[model samples]
Target chain A: MKFSISRSQFIKTLNDVQRAIASKATIPILTGLKIAVSETGVTLTGSDADISIEATITQSDEKAQLLIEEPGNIVLPARFFGEIVKRLPEDQMTLTVGEGFQTTITSGTSSFNLNGLDANGYPHLPEIDAENKLTLPADILKQIISQTVIAVSNQESRPILTGVHILVKDNQLLAVATDSHRLSQRKLEINNGQGLEYDVIIPGKSLTELSKIITDDLEEVDLRITENQVLFTAGPIKFYSRLLEGNYPDTDRLIPHDATTTIEFNTQKLLASVERASLLSHASQNNVVRLVLDPEAKEGTIYSNSPELGNVQESLAFENLTGEKLDISFNPDYMKDALRSFGPTDIKVAFTSALRPFTLVPSEDEENFIQLITPVRTF
Target chain B: MKFSISRSQFIKTLNDVQRAIASKATIPILTGLKIAVSETGVTLTGSDADISIEATITQSDEKAQLLIEEPGNIVLPARFFGEIVKRLPEDQMTLTVGEGFQTTITSGTSSFNLNGLDANGYPHLPEIDAENKLTLPADILKQIISQTVIAVSNQESRPILTGVHILVKDNQLLAVATDSHRLSQRKLEINNGQGLEYDVIIPGKSLTELSKIITDDLEEVDLRITENQVLFTAGPIKFYSRLLEGNYPDTDRLIPHDATTTIEFNTQKLLASVERASLLSHASQNNVVRLVLDPEAKEGTIYSNSPELGNVQESLAFENLTGEKLDISFNPDYMKDALRSFGPTDIKVAFTSALRPFTLVPSEDEENFIQLITPVRTF
Candidate 1:
């Protein structure tokens, strides 16, 4: 493969593809990135079995500054190639692959010859049906991923729980993630026909990588879901990820129906108070922080005590504190995460009792997002 | 200790002392900071086995914003105290100690109650005689430490080599460090009389911490060297570090007397080329890069080849290449370090032969600094 490309353009594409290159892959060749140059353009691919990323630059893309002299293919070690390209002395770099897959990269007075593996050895990307396809704005998709991805189960014992369950009906798209301790769910409006519905469980790890590729500025991404695989196309980049096989658990019933106690406060103020209280609770084994509300006094306090370290208490005034005097304890980290996922505004926190789960929702009705956390039994 | 100190001032003092607090110390009290409150001001002390730092804030100083309610002393856990002071909700924080050393820190609506150890249990700072004293600018001392400290031996086999050997003669202060593979020596002129000389070896780890405390704005630090310890007093902060006991190695003999080949080049240009070559060499086990100079062509080339990764070659036009043609191999990391130690200007890279060690010196005559790296034998 012989091609001369602009350094800046090549760098952007290389970074997107390198994200899928596993640090340690079961198959050694999977650790490399495949580079194929044709008379028309160039293509780069990286895969780690579960997710694959392919970026393409065509000769028609004058901004990419690509000119293909020969048509060939080779796979180079992803990390070494990336590092070398980043340090090239000039703005333009020319790549040439010789016999036996010896690739040479030249720019200015510097030239790097990297050993390349046979591209034929790399596994081909699986084909997915495009019958069920939907186009959504990249910004909304990124928001959905960030809001729910953090709540996915980190343990491997329950494989299905490690993915975010995404559902697309008539004109609505919903994403939900729960690790048994906490749950995050978000819904958005989609422009899709009523004749089709899509349900897929995408691994949280894959969504994180996808979010990085789908930057906020990008306008839209075309998504296609098949039986066992899903393909996402953002501009000239194609991202493919494997779908989880098992059925996702029904989490609708897990969310509490009615609230016994409700309190409204500034999101940032409550977050800061809980963070200070967590200073001591984090040192404790249970990582629990108690929330005490006084109806008559019209005040609320966050308290945490560690036998060996000490104790911390913070009082935050709430707009509306009503219901029977309530005291509850839960993992402070979960609450911090839930607060961070919302915009800086007032949030309504509802609790059923001290031992049951609690839910937090933004006060504004425009954003359909909810976070639930199961309280810890402190007494 | 009881004081309503400025949150910002308290944070700065706490950070300086916390550097000396060991994460896990042999003596439990060493993990806490000794805070003494007086009618005039407050003093905070933190110490590990090797080093101790004391920062004092007096009421007379307008910048500290300190108010002493009572006079007392108590030791609080360094890490916890530092965190609380940093996150106080208000500009002013009031710390009050009650019976049994129960300390309460209150600010705005936030309160933290920490268990404090008795001040009597904390170890005392060793007494050091001030018979030999010299005052030097903090900027120069920080420079001397940065230039030589990187070469200090990290291995414990030679305990003395782990510290930088400092020799203060009639009017010059010399600092040197080496780990057998490379040596760095730097000297600065001090305004000392021809009466007495000072010699001591301070641990590299301690110097690293001291560098953080010596900000650029500070003017001078009083240096006092005793038999077993050295004390540095910068403004209201006093830093004491234990000196290493064993005799330093005779590194004077390691520097080459004459150079057979002397090549001068721009420091930044050469550094950039070698950094690229290190991309592949660093991936290899030995991290070796070859330097080939051609006197006839008045140019130099850096080359590195890995059997599995391929090769990299970079050529640069030298300012002046004289003497016989030469080629040598050495660890690129050591060369990078030696080059970085020099000021950004033309540096003279001198070599005797392929087997002998080489030296790097500044092309200018103002600063007296030399770095030597033993070349690796590739044959």
Candidate 2:
């Protein structure tokens, strides 16, 4: 392959694809990024076993400044070549295939001869037809992933919990993720119907990488689901992730249907107060912080106690407090995460009792997102 | 301590002293900060075995808003309390010492009751007289520490090498540090003549902590050297660091006087070129990058080769090239460090040969700083 491209455009494309490059060299060939040069432009592909990313640079875009001379493919070590190109002090870079599967990259006065593997040795990306594609706003997808992905379990004991379960009905799309300790659920309404109802589990790790490349400014992203793989395409980038095959737990039962007391508080104020209380509670065994509600005083108080250190109490003014006055303790970190995910100026927290899980949602009815956290047994 | 002070001021003082708080819990008291409240105001101190810091808040600057209700001293866990006050969403925090050495910290609607240890249980700071003190520009000290501290050995094999040696002559102050493999020496001309000549070795770790609290904006800092500790007092902050008791090696002989060749080039360009070359060289057993210079051409070429990763070559243009043509290889990381420390638009490099050490200094004569790195013997 022989091609000349703008340094900035090449770096930007390489960055998008490099996230999927295998960090571990167990399979040496998998550590390299495959580059293909065509008459139109150039395409770079990087993949581990779990995810694959391909970024295309087109000559049609005047800003890209890409000129293709020969059409071929080569696979070069992703990290080293990426660093070399990034540090090269030049506006344009040239790539050419040399003898013995060697790739020569030149920019300014710097040139690199990289030992490359044959493109044929790299694994091919899964092909998904457009007929199985569904469209959604990129912003909605990013929001769903960010809100729920952090709740996914890092432990592989139950591999399904490591993935975010996505369910698309006739007009609504729902995303849910939980690691048994905490859960996040978000729903969005999509106008276009794909004429199909499907449920798929996409790994949280892959969604995180996909989120990094997707711009919130973009309006739409095409998502295609195959039996074993899921593809998300935006503009000139195609992201493919291996789907987790298993039945996701019934999270519907995990969320509480009724609440004894519900209080609306400022999100920022609550987050800061919880963070301060966590400083003491984090030293304790259960990292628990207690919340006390006073209907007469119309105030909500958060307290944290550590046997060896100290105790902290913070009183927050609430917009409204109803139902029986209650005192409950739960993990401060979970509350912090739940409050952060609310992403609204005001949040309403519904609590049943000390033993039951609580739900946090935006005070405004526009955003349909909920986060639930099970209270810790402080006694 | 029973004092109500500005929250920002208290947080800033806590930040400075907390740097000395021990991360390890080997000595329980070492992990806590001792606060003394008197008619004068409040004094906060934190110490590990190697370093201690003390910051005082005077009653005169309290502006009537800050009140000292009682005089007392107590030690509280540093990490937890520091984090609590920093994250508290209040403008003013009131601290009160109650019965049983219990401390209550209240700010806005938040309050913390911390279990505190009696001041008698905390170790006393070393007493140092300021009469025979020497004052230096804080920026200069920060620069000296940053330039030479990185070369100090982290290994405990050579205890003296883990500290930077400061030698005070009649009219000069010299700082030297080495890790056996490489050495860095810096000298500054001082006008003050105390008619005293002394050599003290300060631990690299202590200097690192000191550097963090010493702002470049501060004009001068008083340095008081006692029998076992050195104290740096800048404004209201007093930093004490235990001296490393050992004889530092004589690093004067390590700097070569004569050079076979010398070249001047853009510092940033050379740094970028070396970084790109390092991408390949770092993959090999010996991370070495070779520089070949032709005096006649006024141009130099750098190359890095890895057995499994091929090679990278970059040519750099020099402003001036003199003396004999040369070829030398050295670890790119050392050169990167030297370049980072020797911050200037242009750098002049003097090389003895392929196997000898070289010196890098700013091309401008105004900035008097030099960094030397030993060449790796790459077979």
Candidate 3:
């Protein structure tokens, strides 16, 4: 195989595929990047068994400026190859494989000779026999993944909770995740998913990598799902992730619909206050901050203290306070994450009781998106 | 004690003093910042026993906007106090200490009550009883520290080698450091240093911290040395570092005056090539790269290889070549550090033999600054 291409263009695609490659793969060959050079284009593949990424640079790509002298396939150490390409002396770098597995990489007066592996040992891409394809805007798809993935459990105790449960039915797409302590659910109205029902649980880590590759430059992404593998096509890149096996817990029943008290606060302002309160709480053993709301007195405050250190209290500026007065305590880190997903909008928070789960939703669109948190019994 | 100061102004002085405060101090009180509020200004001090830094914010300073309501003093947890001050909600914050060393900090609606210690328990700054004072430009002082500190030995086997030997004699200030394998020396001509001879060894760690606080805003820093302590006063900040109590080794005889082979190359280009070669050497057992120079052919090339990975070779772009053909091996990391110290200038490298030490000096000013490295004997 022999080819020379623009370093920047090649680096961009290399970075995207690198996201799926693990430094320590159980299979030795999985750490190598598989490159297939054909008559018209070059395809680069990186995989970590569970997730695989493939990108194609066609001959017609103007920015790539690809020149192919021969056609062949080989696998090279992904990390070392990447580092050498980044430090190459010129704008263009060439890769040539001659006799045996001796591959030579050259740019300007610098030359690197690497031992390549047989590409036949690398696993092939997962094939999906499904014919139906669903399409969604890149931005909206990224939002759904981020909002729900935050609540996914990092603990391996419950393997099923490590993924976000995605469901599409009745022209509406719903994504939800719960770590038993807190749950987040996001909904989007799909114009073409009507009369079709599909349920799958995608690992939070896979979705995170997929969201990063789905940049603003991509207008829309096409998704195809089979029994075990799901593929997302964005521009010249294809992302594939294996679905988690097992049924997700019923988190829908955990969110409380009734509330004893409700208050609306600017997401950014309250986020800052929670951050400050968390500083003291993080120094404490429980890592919980208290919120005391007095509807009749028209005031609210957050209090947190560390036994050996000191205490902090901030008077909260709240709006639309109603119902009975209440006192609640919860893990500030969870609240911080849920608040960040709401961005700078005003969010209405409802408390069922001191020990029950509370819910927070955007004031403008309450029915579409919601984040629920189970409060601690500080008394 | 009670006073309100602009948060930004207070933060600047706080950051400077915080450099001296170590998170894990042998003395608990040493971890707290000593703040003395007087009728004229507020003085903040931080110390880790060996080094102490104090910065004052006067009431007359426009940017400080310090309002002194009362005169008193106290010591508060340096790390926690600095973190709180950075996240305060307003442009200005007020700090007040009541009876029994109870401190109150407030900004906007947020209030923090911290446990404060008695100022009388804090150790006093060392009294350097020196009448004579020498001054140097802040930029030049910073440059001298950066150039030589890189060669200071980090090994604890010989604690005395962890400092840079500084000598001021005959209107010239010279600084040099070495880890036995490599050495760096810098000299500066001082007009007022004549008739004064002083020699001391300052810890490399102290010089690094002093270099950071000696920013471009200050014109000159006044230096005073007496007994075992050295004081550097720059504007409102006073930095004190304890001098090592031992004699430094004589490095004059180690630098070779004659050379069998000589070559000159641009510092930046050589540094880039060395960085590339080090990537492969770092993966190898010996961590060494070989440079083959052919004066007859007017060529030089660097080669490095890893038994498990690959090998890389770069043809060097050099200027003057009036030396015998030779192949030498050296630690690329040491070479990288020496090349970086020269920046982007053309440097002349003098080699005595394949096993002996080599020297590098800027072509423009060869007498003032020089760097030397010992080559590895590769069979």
Candidate 4:
């Protein structure tokens, strides 16, 4: 294959697909990125067995300035090839595949000859059903992914908890992720559900990568789910992730309905206070911070202590406080993540005794999005 | 000590002193920063036994807004205190030392009570010969530090090679550093010699830290040398470093005066080509790139390859080439560091033979600064 294209435009697509290529894949061929050139366009594919990303550049693309001399395919070492393209001397670069898949990249007076693997040896991508695709605004999908992924379990003990449980029914899309200790749920109203219902557990990591690729330039992202694979398409980029097997835990019953005390605070203010309190708690063994709220006294205080480092106490800033007095101890990192996901909005936090789980929801939209955290039994 | 100061102003000085504070200090007190508050100003000192940095914030400084309520001293954990000050909620923060060395730092409604040590336990800074002082432009000093420190040996096998040999004599200041494989030498002309001569070896790590603190705001830095210490005073910041107690090797004889071949190229262009060749060389075991210069053909080419990956060859751009044909191989990493130290200028490279060391110097002024690298004997 021989093609000359705008280096900057090619680099953009290269970066997008390079995200899926792992540095050390068990299958050595998967470590390389597949490049297929045709009369109409060029397609770049990268895979790590579990996740695969494909980006296409067409001759019709004005910015790409693609000039195809021949049609063929080659798989080059993803990282090294990327580095070479980035450091090319000119605005444009030409890539050609020669005898025995020996590819040469030439830009200005510099040329890089690399041994390429046969693209035919690459594993075939899963065939997604286009008719079952569900489309959503890129912004909303990105927000949902960011909010829920934080609660996904990083541990491999419970494999299902590593994914976000996505459910679509009655024209409402719900996304939930939990690590047993904390849970996050976001609800998005769908206008074009088309009377279709589907339930799937998508790996949180996949959603994170998908959210990143859904840049501001992208208006919408289309999702198609097969039995074991899910595909999300944004513009010319197609992202495919293998669905996690087995049923996700029912987290609907995990959120608390009743609360003994409730306090409203600006997310930014509480985040700062929690971050400060965490300094000492992180230095300590248990990594727990305590929050004391008194209804009659109308006071709130956050405290944390490290045996070797000392202690910290701050008068927590709150907009509103009501109901019974309560004292709770929990992981400050979880609280920081939940507060950050709320952005700069005012959030109301509800507590159900010292050991029970507490929920934090945006004050204006309490029913749509919620973050629940289970308190530590530090008696 | 009790003082209320602008958090930003305090943080600047805190960061400067924190550079001297090591995380795992041999002396426990050296791990902490000593804050000595007087009616006139507040002094923050941090030391790691070998290097000690002290920054003074005066009450007259408007930006500091330092309000000295009392005169006393206390030592606080350098890193922890810096982190606390950075995350404080208000522009102004008050730090007060109470009974039993307990320190309370309050800003807005957030308060951090930290365990403080007795300031008297902190190690005393080295006393230098203030009368015999040499002042130089901060920019020039920073440049000299940056140029030579790159060649300093990181391995502690020969501890003296880890420092830059500095000699001041005959109205000229010369600095040189080498790891045996590559050497960098820089010389600065001094206007006032004062008929005094001195030679010292300052640790590269100390100079690196000192260079960072010499920001653009500072005009000049005063150097005071003692029996075994070198102190650099930049405005209110005093950086004290213990001198290496050994004689430096004579590097003047190591430079070759004659050359069989020579080539000149823009520093930036040559650096780019070297960087590209390094990509493939880095993947290989020996990590070497080859340079072929043929005077008859007026051609210069750079090549590097990996047994497992492949190879890269580039037609080198040069302004002039003369004398004899040569083929040399050397570690690209050493060449990269030498080229970067030259900044952006046309450089003349002189080679004696394929196995001999080559010298690179600025084309405009060849006498003041020179970088030499020993070529690898590739069979």
- After superposition, candidate 3 runs with Cα above 4 Å error: none
Cα displacement (Å) at residue B119, model 2: 1.4
Report the C-alpha lDDT of model 4 over B117-217, residue by residue, as the tens digit: 99888888887756878889999999999999999999999999999999999989999999999999999899876965889999999999999999999
lDDT, candidate 1, residue A173? 87
Q: List the residue pairs that clash in candidate 3.
A: none
Q: Give the number of the best model, judged by lDDT.
A: 4
lDDT per residue for candidate 1 within B1-379, as digits (tens), equals 5789888888888888899998789998999989998889899999997999998889988777888888999999888888888877889999999989999999999999999999988888989877777888889888888889989999999999999999988798889999999999998888763465887899999998999999877999889888999999988899999999989999999998888899887888888898999998988888899999989877789999888899999897577888889999999899888888776888888899998999988899525999999999999
lDDT of 4 at A178: 96
Number of backbone clashes in candidate 4: 0
What are the runs in model 2 whose C-alpha is more than 4 Å off?
B62-65, B366-368
Over the full model, what C-alpha lDDT does candidate 3 score relative to the true structure?
0.93
True contacts kept of each: 0.86, 0.98, 0.70, 0.77
Question: Model 2: clashing residue pairs?
Answer: none
Ranking by lDDT: 4, 3, 1, 2
**CAPRI quality of model 4:** medium
- Candidate 1 true-interface contact recovery: 0.86
Docking class of 3: medium
- lDDT tens per residue, model 2, B148-223: 9988999998898999998888778888888876777888887774765768999999899989998756888888
lDDT of candidate 2 at residue B15, scale 0 to 100: 89
The sequence of per-residue lDDT tens digits that candidate 2 reaches over residues A1-379 is 7888888988888999999997676778888999988888788999987999998898997777898889999998888888887887788888899788888989889989988889998888888875867888888888888999978889999999999999989888889999898999999887886576779999999999999998856788998888889999987899999999989999998988788998888888888888888888888876888899988878789888889888988888678889879889888888887788776588888899988888888888635888888887767
Worst 10 residues of 3 chain B by lDDT: B189-198
